[model samples]
Target: MAETMYDKIWNAHAIVERDDGQTLLYVPRHIVQEGSRFAFEFLQDRGLTVRRPRQMLASPQMSISTRRRDIEEITNPDQRLTVELLIENTRKFGVTHYGLDDPRQGIVHVVAPELGFVQPGTVLIIGDSHTCTAGAMGTLAIGVGATDVLHVLATQSIWQRKMRSLRITVDGILPEGVTAKDVILTIVGRIGANGGKGHVFEYAGSAIRAMSVEERLTVCNMSIEAGARSGMIAPDDTTFDYLAGRQFAPRGASWDRALRYWRSLPSDEAARFDREIHIDAATLAPMVTWGTSPEDVVPVDGRIPDPRAEPDAERRAHMEKTLGYMGLAPGTPVTDIAVDQVFIGSCTNARIEDLRAASAMIRGRRAVVPAFVVPGSTQVKHMAEAEGLDVIFRKAGFGWGEASCSMCVGMNGDTVGAGKRCVATISRSAAGRQGRGSRTHLVSPAAAAAAALTGRITDIRKMGA
Candidate 1:
């Protein structure tokens, strides 16, 4: 029988299926962040210790201050405790941890893959929705809740229901100004927010193949926004190239063995998916979210939609409410929407490639708004500095920040002020995702940079990007 990559990985890890339908699967990799403190507490309450400490990776992410590493300087008591508790728990369990002072410390999703802890044919579970970012390496990555986190901590295996496979194929060449972030925003808009419920997505075809590993990570990072359980890309030359010299990837004879296994993991030619969608990449433009939902998207030159034109009463009412909250009026051009701030950092689009693209756009232009650039990890921060990208950004009137989740999660003191409009390169733009009463226009880093320069949602093409 032909097998999809998901089937191959799932079958490899599946231990036993119960009559009621839950299957026990051995997960080889697990990542926990500061938000996972409750799971640790639960484990302690149950008188348990982590079963496979070596397989677990821990970091303090959700609440760390991007400005300072000192615990006393964190300002928010809750945020400081999150970091302190994670350190205490990881040390007690003997699990390897990346502290704020560690060079490997970063957004957990970003740090794992960049350091090669996530690999092809592995099953990885994390307490973050963006864990699917590691699926770019052909890993089966899934996000879990607190109970599941505790389960994974006490036992290396987890119980799960099967996910149907949804294949999304994007063919044709992307336009010059289009990017991976734009591609994903377009996908979510076309499919709607709940498009991939109860399914795992396999992104493939010419456009996906052409994207660099980091770009593919950006595409998969937002699978959750599309209501998918997870998203993955099959391993290929690109995946292998990115992992070749990575810190934790296999080496020498082990590398040869791993390559052989990965080569066989892609779906067979006759493999069938439960559902499939095809897209023409040439039709996509740089997209921005007009309202609170990821599906409320439009091309750079598009206008805000009029709720009165919607045929469905329920949808019309919701659209009107969204627009009211966003402070946007019908027929208003998105390109004319002025922003008070700009953020260019997230697990979705904060790799070196994203930094380079944003820097190129504002290299000689000064930002009209208060724009900030936070790298995804300390390693990425150092890499940008080595290439002078940080200097370019600082010279353009953009604030260079330390590596952290920063304004994306909004609990780290880096937030869009109340009722302010912000152009962000993060994954989602739901109300209050950045801060209380904040309005977010989500776009690619290049687009965000263009907006920072113009103080409005200017088209990247118009800015010569």
Candidate 2:
């Protein structure tokens, strides 16, 4: 019997089938953050201790600042306390901790894969919704609530119902300026925010296979925005190559054993999925979200939709409300919109490749508005500096920030001001995702750079990107 990649991974992780049709899954690794404070407290109240401290990785991502080089620079007292609490709790339980001062410290999702803690054929979960980002390495990554956090803390495993599978196949070749970010926004737009609900999305086909591991991470990272349970790409040479020399990845003889296991995890040709969606990659253009949700997006050159013209009453109302909040008129050209700020960092688009892409556009140009260009992690920051990418960005007048989630999550004081419109490379554009009353137009890094240079929603293709 041919097994799907999802089935192979899921079955291998399943320890026992519950009579109620659920399975007890053995969680190989658990990524915890400041958000897990309550979970830790919950365990503490019951006199419980972490079952596998080494298998659990903890970090204070939510309270960490991209603006600060050291812990004392985090001025917000409450934030400082939250970070301290997380560190204290992790210490109390003996969990492997990555504090703000830790060189590998970063958003849980970004740090995990970069440091090689995440790998193919592993079942991992974090409290943050973007845990799906790790799925790029062919791991079954899921996001759970604090209660599930406590469950994993005590047992190092989780009980779960089976998830259906949906495969999205991207055909043809991507045009010169099109990016993984655009491709994902296009998918969410077509599928609607809830279209992929109740399923795991397997991103496949020629276009996806051609993407680098980092690009695949960007794609899977946003699967949550499409309302999917999770998203993943199969492990191939690209996956092994990316993980080859990472600090936490298997070394020597262990590496050989790990590689052999990963090689057999891809879905067989005869594997079946519950649903399939096909996209023509060549047809995709630079995309930007027009409304509060990711699905409310269009090509950069496209116009805002008229809600009254929509036949579905509920959807029409939603469009109208979102448009009202966005201060956009029906049929308004997206290019006509001007941005007040531009953000170029997030777990989704803050990788080295994305920074280089932005640098190509920002090299000699000055930013027309405030632009916050943050790296995804310290390692990324150092790598970009070693390549002199920081000089190009700083000379262009962009704020070169330290590594963390930065403006994407709107915490840590890196926020788009109230009522301000921003062009961003973050995964989500939901109202308040960037900050209260902030209107976010999600785009690729190149597109974001073009917007910052022009102070408007300009297409990267037109700017020669």
Candidate 3:
């Protein structure tokens, strides 16, 4: 049978199908973040341990604490406890190798491909919604909750129902100032946020064909926001080229063999998807979020939506609340909105290519708002600094911060102040996300750069090459 990319990857990892219709899938790799500390503690308390104690302990120390019943509990515990528990647990049950800082320690999804943990035919799971980011590598990666995390940790597998396939084909060359961010945002706007619910998306067409692996990663990273279980682009030369020479990528003869294998992962032209969405890439413009949801977005030159004009009472009420929180008047021009900060980082846009694009725009321009850039990984940070990208940003009036999740979640002490609004490249704009009472307007790197210069939402096209 002709198979889609998802089918090839899913079948490769399928261990068994239960009578209940759920397939047991073997996980080739698993990733967790600081938020996973609770899961760790839960395991310890239950006497369930991890396999490969030394490997688990090798993970970087995360500085996170949780307040339980007014008592501060350190979730990570000491390295000794982490290692011992993992060793004990893995021995009791069984597990694949536990990878530490192994060059794949940043965001689980980002680090996985950078470190070659996600290959063309593999099943990857992580305790993060953005685990879909790995789908860019042609893998079937999905997010699981803490309970599922424990289950996978104990059994090295998890059960999942089959998801219908949705193919989103975007063709044509993108216009200036348009990007992968804009493409995904436009798709969300067209389909509405929940359009892809219960579906796995396969991105195709010339526009997708033109995207680099990093750009494709950004597109898939936000698939969850559109209610898709996951999203993937077929593996090709672009994918292999990006993976080649990476710290964890296969070399010499292995590289040739891997490339051959990756080429075979694409779907046949005759393969059929359960649903299809077609978009013209040239029609997409520089997009920005005007309200709390990713779907509350418009072109850079557009205006905020008026709830009073909405025909549905339920939708109107929702829009009214969003307008109030965003401090946006109905019909106010989105481009006229002023910003107090411009953040250019997050797993979505913090890659080296994103930094380079922002630097090019900010060069020789002083930021009118407090502006900053953060790399997605420690290695990315070092590479950018080595190439003098850091100097260009600092000279252009932006702060250069260490590699971490940074301003993406407003965690780690980096936050937008109360009542302050920011033009951010990060995903999500929920209330109090950047900080308590802080407002975020999501944009692309070019839009963020223009906003930094003018201290308002500005058309990135006007900035010029």
User: Which number leads on lDDT?
Assistant: 1
The TM-score values for the models, in the order shown, are 0.99, 0.98, 0.89
Is 1 or 3 the stronger prediction by lDDT?
A: 1
Count of residue pairs whose backbone atoms collide, per candidate: 0, 0, 4
Q: Against the true structure, candidate 3 has what lDDT?
A: 0.77
Which candidate, 2 or 3, would have the higher TM-score against the true structure?
Answer: 2
> Candidate 1, clashing residue pairs?
none
After aligning candidate 3 to the native by TM-score, how far in Å is the CA of 180 from where it should be? Answer: 0.8
Once fitted onto the true fold, the runs of candidate 2 whose alpha carbons sit more than 4 angstroms away are none
In the range 1-465, model 2's lDDT, one tens digit per residue, is 988899999999999998998999999989998888889889999999999998988776666777676778778888777788888998988988878777787778888889999999999989888999988899899999999999999999998898899999999999989999999999999888999899999999999999999999999999999998689999999999999999889999999999999999989999999999999998999999998999999999999999988999999999998988888899999999989999999889999999999999975889989998999888889999999999999999999988878799877888888889999999888898888999999999999999999999998778852
lDDT rank order = 1, 2, 3
Model 2 pairs whose backbones collide: none
Tens-digit lDDT string for candidate 1 (48-144): 9999999988877768777766667688898888889999999999999999889898888889889999999999999778888888899999999
* Per-candidate local distance difference test: 0.92, 0.90, 0.77
lDDT of 3 by residue, 163-224 (tens): 99999999999998898999988888777778889999999999999999989998998898
For TM-score, candidate 1 versus 2, the one ahead is 1
Error of 3 at 126 (Å): 1.0
How many residue pairs clash in model 2?
0
lDDT winner between candidates 1 and 2: 1
